[model samples]
Target: MSVTAPAPKRIELSLPALHPEQERILRESSRFNVIRAGRRFGKSTLGRHVLMNAALQMAPVAWVAPTYKRLTPQWREICATLNPVIARRSEEEKHIDLIGHGGEIDFWSCDGGGFPGEGRKYKLIVCDEVAMLGSDLERIWTRSLRPCLTDLQGGAWFLSTSKAASSYFTQMYSWGQGERPEWKSWQMRTADNPYILPSEIAAAKQDLPAAAFLQEFEGDAVSFSGSVFTNLEQAIVDAPLPEQYERWAQQRSWMAPETEFFIGCDWAGAGRRAGGDFTAFVTMAKDGTICAIERFKADFALQRVRLAGLVSRFRPAAVLAEENSIGAPMLSALRASGISVQGWTATNATKHKAVEALALGFEEGRVKIYDVENRAVLLAELMSFEATSLPNGMTRFAAPSGGHDDLVVACFLAYLASHRPRVGECAWSPI
Candidate 1:
């Protein structure tokens, strides 16, 4: 008797339920799907659904974010969601193999300056927060990832809130709606999400600047004119420390204990209310190297505890907190914790001095920052800062409407503290 071979076990795959808007966009027959949505409009969730569903059909799918660090959370979620149907997962390569679909979803970062989906055929590609990927986004799509889709006739989806009207994201959105016959687009606000409260949006509108409200909540690409700092990109040390710094620092290991650390603090409002400003702490070395930065929104008392912990870890020579509003209390609280904290009053003159110093640092290549792609808000603030000239010939520096400069201010403080003279330092020149 001849025995027949057993059939392969069927693996059930189901797409996650999506919101009505998400479903509508997915239903579009266009090869390109573009969405310009307000913040909190469920863009990430929709992207997840799109990638997962695509994997069930024709794949390997590709998900691209501005940076690897930003893509990490989504990568974890995708792995967890498809764990049951996953055949293998390569964390090192950020690749996943499905059980029965012959499908894989790989995550890539645009910040690495390489073609993400090169040489690989993809059935679907999702670019989350494409606006933050910078100006070369068009080349990334048309030159790099688009060719990968040719073999499978795969589709591409672009998702982001408006960054600027002149940005590649807005151009793509326009092309998707009109210029491209194979594309479709959708624009929606946070209000469209029934899960969000109307009062919350109203409060946001009131709190945010007019242009910021329009861009962030109204899905408009407002122009960024009169920006103060322009050389942020040139100053960013995206990868490891530069070889020059490494060599010099390695030669100076004899003075490790003498190297003073500085901390700059920007205290958030009390009550730790939702949507409040952040308490940013920037730590730097005496040599003007930014070591680390942390931002939090919590109660003043709680923040002090956190500060104390950081103080012990950093062993800062001096902690400078902005001496305004809740900052005064926070500085005192930190000092009471036996930390060497000081209050730095933020008057117009002092703020102007600090801001100019920071701008000069970036311009002169004296200050260096890391994790530019991951720490987006900080980088954005540094780039979007603007200075206005008053009728009296005075200049006021601040972040554009709807943006926070807490990180920038904290960084400025760190930079300022880095130059302070240490005890037993000579006042006369060595020469």
Candidate 2:
């Protein structure tokens, strides 16, 4: 009897050609590698290659993200790239077994609201988008994933786009590049990607807000001035409004004809990307009192539905929304849905005007903010807002890098819409 030997471990895999930076990362000998790269720099692709290589070497691996929803695309990419080598797969558990190798790859979320994969040991671990993983990252790594690597003397990889200089990702990168003998790091920009176009990067540089452009394209950890709204004080901001003020303001029947409420929205895009910008809405009374402020991290369609619901409930006098890329189309969609929303183009001049108007209201103690939580958010953003003068005499107003000004923007638009000059009202009149 002749027993045929098991077919030689035949492996066939195809991936996009790696750029020089990716090749350098792959060739590095560091047990712990950190990549601080701008968005669209092919970090994910490199991460997949790292994880797959470890698996083929007969090591157990786990690819983790902040949440499972965010991990879906990576899982798809892995399956598509390794179809021939995958012996079996489990979608529910996000696990895959490689043919002829006693190896497996498990895709998991850090599972922030629930338990992360705690007890299982892994030879390789990849944490993608590490900066956006929030403040729980240290705990997740130290208390959970770290122990899993002890048995195998395994390696780990961290990948993220730049957020803030104060962010934990930056902190880790700093340590890895200095004190840690086991760790090493690489920093690159989106423009470094051979697949991306220089014109595209230039357009992004011109189109995005300065802070955002620096963080998203240049991979800079930016830090700037203190809060822009100097007049913000607890005495004025935390003052209590009437009983059930928010409910009364949100319900249309309780509104008086003369009591105009304006809504300002900073819409997110069509939800094409994960962890994208949030859509924020601030509702204000004509007298400059904040009634309600809501922020949603959703796509354009869902945000429009939400806006329509708000319009029906509040019967706002005017809806002032950003009229830039996503905003213009969103305004059209809302109009098509029978909601009358006005679009305001965001430029240096318009932004300064609106922000200054809001600041003046705060200074005059005319802006009454309600709800302690919402008040905190608005106050935080306002405090972080900055106005810097360029060499050419142009002043730029924006939030700090990696920080959001959505609530502040919404507030400014709402303030602008409600405080417009009356027929005989003077531009210099008291706010």
Candidate 3:
């Protein structure tokens, strides 16, 4: 009896095709590979292709994003291509047990509970939209996911767009820039995706804002519009101070001082419920260098105590508190505490002017900071700053929606009020 020929082995593979960048990222075998590109540039598509291949090889892969909603669309795309049978299954049957047996893909968001439980370990973990993940999630990734891969001889693949230059994705980019023992990077723009239609790209460029076009389509690190301090890297220094260095912080007391100092304040009212702005206190030396900076939320007694503490700690020459709702009360409180304080009102002077002055200091390399924390907050706020004009023919400087500018506003006020030579004044005036 002739035996029927065994049915041809079924090879299940899910991927349209591999592009050059995808090939490089997949074949490198590095411990880390950062895939940075613009939106709709096939970043997720390439990520799915690599993950599916790894899973087919019996490598347990984990896919994650900032949230479940962000990962769902790509999860559906991957499911349709890799496991049509599973995809067609009813939602009730989509549980992990049913999918795991069929070599199906499992997706999750970067929430507290999304991490794998005790039983299973992932061989490869792919993090998408990495920029949006919180710092706590990053800690989980390094502490949990990285170690799991060690036993499986696997690596992680990071896929994301170029978010803010100070975001987690940028941090990864910085790490990849160095020669790591096991890591690599692959960057590309929307133009790199051959499959994307040119007409579509042109349409996007026409419809999107200039900043959005550069960041999402061209993959350029363009700064946000109307930023008060555009060049923060130049304004802030990260170098360590010399052991023998001596300056303002050393020979200063809050009681009184021979050298004059200017106090810059950004007052916030309506208490914490208002969520409008912060109460900031900044003390700058006459030479334009920052001596002391203090920031706190909108609290009456707490802010007063903090301001009093600052005055008693570093005797400022004059306090310039913003003349907003809280300014009057704050000034009164400082006065009651025996602190020298004054109210400074922001006038028709455009936000651009103040920012330009700060930018000039940065360009001249005159701006310096004693601590890095305030500098970081200031940089972030500077990046988010924007200019807007009111209906009454007045322009104002403000932070972008959902942005923080407490430190920046304080810094700007300090820069504006700090002592500067008159436009035509000379150091050696003729008697």
lDDT, model 1: 0.74
Q: Residue by residue across 1-431, what tens digits does model 1's lDDT show?
A: 99999997777655567777767777874889888988988888888888887886647999998888888999998998888888899999999998776688999987765556688999999998877765667788889989999999998889888764566777788888789898888888878777789999999875554555666887776543454554667767767544443343334353564355678888776212235788888877677677667887777777777777666655676777787777676766555555666678888789877876766676657776766332677787787787653322234577767778888888898888776665432111111
Candidate 2, 239-305: lDDT as tens digits: 5665555555445353364466788988766222235777889888777778777887876678888
After superposing candidate 3, which stretches have Cα over 4 Å from the reference?
A: 1-8, 11-14, 27-29, 84-104, 112-119, 207-209, 222-431
Q: In lDDT terms, which candidate is top?
A: 2
Better of 2 and 3 by lDDT: 2
TM-score, candidate number 1: 0.54
Error of 2 at 221 (Å): 0.8
TM-score of candidate 3 versus the correct structure, residues matched by position: 0.50
* TM-score of every candidate relative to the true structure: 0.54, 0.58, 0.50
Q: What does the lDDT read for residue 276 in candidate 2? A: 71
In candidate 2, stretches whose alpha carbon ends up further than 4 angstroms from where it belongs are: 1-9, 113-115, 224-411, 414-431
lDDT of 3 by residue, 5-39 (tens): 98955656546987776666568647787877788
Q: What is the C-alpha lDDT of each candidate?
A: 0.74, 0.76, 0.61
Alpha-carbon RMSD to native, per candidate: 18.5, 15.2, 15.7
